[model samples]
Target chain A: MVKALVFDAYGTLFDVHSVREKCNEWFPEQGEAISQTWREKQLNYFFLRQLMERYEPFDQVTREALRYACKANDVTLRDEAEEELMEAYLNLDLFEEVEEVLSQLNDKKLVVFSNGSPVMIDPLIDRSDISGYIDDVLSADGVKQYKPVPAAYYYAQQELGIEKEDILFMSSNPWDISGAASFGFRTAWINRNGLPKEELDIQPEVEYENLKGLLEWRD
Target chain B: MVKALVFDAYGTLFDVHSVREKCNEWFPEQGEAISQTWREKQLNYFFLRQLMERYEPFDQVTREALRYACKANDVTLRDEAEEELMEAYLNLDLFEEVEEVLSQLNDKKLVVFSNGSPVMIDPLIDRSDISGYIDDVLSADGVKQYKPVPAAYYYAQQELGIEKEDILFMSSNPWDISGAASFGFRTAWINRNGLPKEELDIQPEVEYENLKGLLEWRD
Candidate 1:
């Protein structure tokens, strides 16, 4: 019996890529390049920081990665437009299935396990106002290390007060799914982009292209 | 006070991107996509594996990353051709200025600290015939973790019997530079592509566009 659903917030619960629209609105053709590279660099920086023991908040990582992304793509951040994009990022729209599936599964505890800082995550939840469904927000700063580090998962487990097997852990990142699975959670990989499994030899218990797959299964 | 000049093997001394020529040769007009994606996936796998603690040999990582890159880029890896590429990989030619600079800096104890497996690193050194300059080979398998991990650098420091700052660490990767610098080694980033520094806030002591810059520095 799954007692609760633990979600990886950035890509699994909220669509990190949804910033592409605001990006495109601001910069004509460079939005996709900026958005894609920014997201990739953001995660890459997370791993680098964790390994190097130079921990920074996720919001700072986001801005710094964006700076690198724009520079790498030969785009300029002018007139404080980058700030606009960052602000818009905080209100990132939920994935099409997020609200519905989350509501339908209200009987189970809904928890967010995020790398986002409280300042960054709390507003997004407030703006989206689906905050009611969530029982807890476990941001990585709680442990001073990001996810995939065993310490981060252990912290989440202690807070959730549920046995690892009794929780359904969900993430859209293959690496996160692998990490969570390796940590003994029943993992769901929300592979929204239809990417291949990470070649880490560990496999998630199930995968969905979107969040609704979880709802459909639970229904 | 720099007693040894430690190098990163894959991209700093060897031309990893040279695989693009063979990739283009094997699959008509698909070389750049295959090579770039292959290299990116290779490093991505390193971080993922290290974090997941499901470490594999670097050679195995090269093969697996290539498999993913080929699939991601819609290119098929023919059986004999992948074998052919792996064989070619073993004999990757030195970067244009690698041998010349190593010869110029022969007074220093030149060393290689790589993520390559011995099977991969030893043969590459032998085939390239630059074994005379390198006094030591420290592969990551010694600790079963990839670079930017403190343990990997720690092993190298112990093996060299030299203090961290006394080792002039060199790599073409910004993350490696950042990691080494954080580990208290003076670092030289071979920024061959003139790429921006990683957002980690740890800048290298010096940077070069290629290996020749190191020689030019000592001169």
Candidate 2:
């Protein structure tokens, strides 16, 4: 029986692209491109850092990614403009279905396990309507290891005090799902984009279009 | 004084994007986009596999990356087309200055250290005119650890029988340079495109526009 539902916070529950509006305000006609590049570079930075054994908090990674994205899109990002964009991450829009689904799954332990640092994630959760529905927030920062590295998932499992098979891990990112599944968790891929599954050898046990799919889970 | 020069083959010596012409033949206007995505996903798969302890040869990773890139660009890749594209990797065009530079730096041990499987890399080197100039070829497959991961670099160092500081690692890819730098090898960022540097904390010891800059390095 599953004892807890651990969801990846960024793309799974919070809309990472919500910052596009603020980005647009700073750079006309380039918001969407900047946001897309920023998100891709952000994850790329994480993977590179993890492989290089260079761990930085997610906030720093996000900022560096933004800088690269701006350069790539041929836009200049000033200090104040960068700060505003960074603040936008703290107030990211939660996916529309997140609150209702978390409320329904309140009987189960609902935790946010993410690469996001607590400084960013805590405020994100505290500001959201589903804050009360979440039982815990775990950051990869705590272990100084990012996802897909076994240590990060193992840290979450230890913190939850549950066996890996008794925890259902959900992530909107295919790579995250692959990582969790490889780590032996019962994974649910919250593939919101309706994209094809990644070619990684590991497969998630279940696939969901959104959090509401979690309601179908028994025990 | 540098005892040997280690190079990253894909982007550093071989122009990975040179396959664009073949890709264009198959996908027309979408060739550049497909090639870019294919290269990005190829490296991503390597990092993810390394982090997840799921090791696959570079040939398989390259093929899988092509499949995703084709799907992403909305192109149908027949088995024969796939074979052609995969074949293109083995015969990638060497950067214009690679042969001249390698011929000039013949005094030092010139090694190709890469994540590429020997199956692909060996033939690639054998087909290049610079083959006579290269001293040794070391692959991540030898250790089942990809670059940016310290173990991979250490494997190359062990195979070369040289100290880290005495080796000058060169790569057109910033992440590879960063990884080699972090591994304690002196690094040169072959910024062939004159792109901005990545924000990773580690920095290469030198920056050059292309392989020709290696000519200035003296023991």
Candidate 2, B85-137: lDDT as tens digits: 99999999998988888888887889999899999999999999999998999
Native contacts present in each candidate (fraction): 0.58, 0.67
**Which one is best on TM-score?**
2
Docking class of 2: medium
List the lowest-lDDT window of 10 residues for candidate 1 chain A.
A210-219
Q: Which ranges of candidate 1 are over 4 A from the true structure?
A: B75-79
lDDT of 1 at B143: 86
lDDT of 1 by residue, A1-219 (tens): 888799998888888888888888877888888899999899989999988888999999999988888888887877587898889888997888788889988988999898898888888887885798998888888898888987788889988888999889999987788889988888889999899666556799998899888976651
Tens digits of lDDT, candidate 2, A43-141? 989999999988999999999999999998888899999999999999999999999988888888899999999999999999989899999999999
lDDT of 1 by residue, B58-90 (tens): 999999988888888877788988998788788
| Model 1 CA lDDT for position A73 | 83
Query: Once model 2 is optimally superposed onto the true structure by TM-score, how far is the C-alpha of residue A4 displaced, in angstroms?
Result: 1.0
Query: For all the models shown, what interface RMSD does each have?
Result: 1.7, 1.4
Considering every candidate listed, which one attains the maximal DockQ? 2
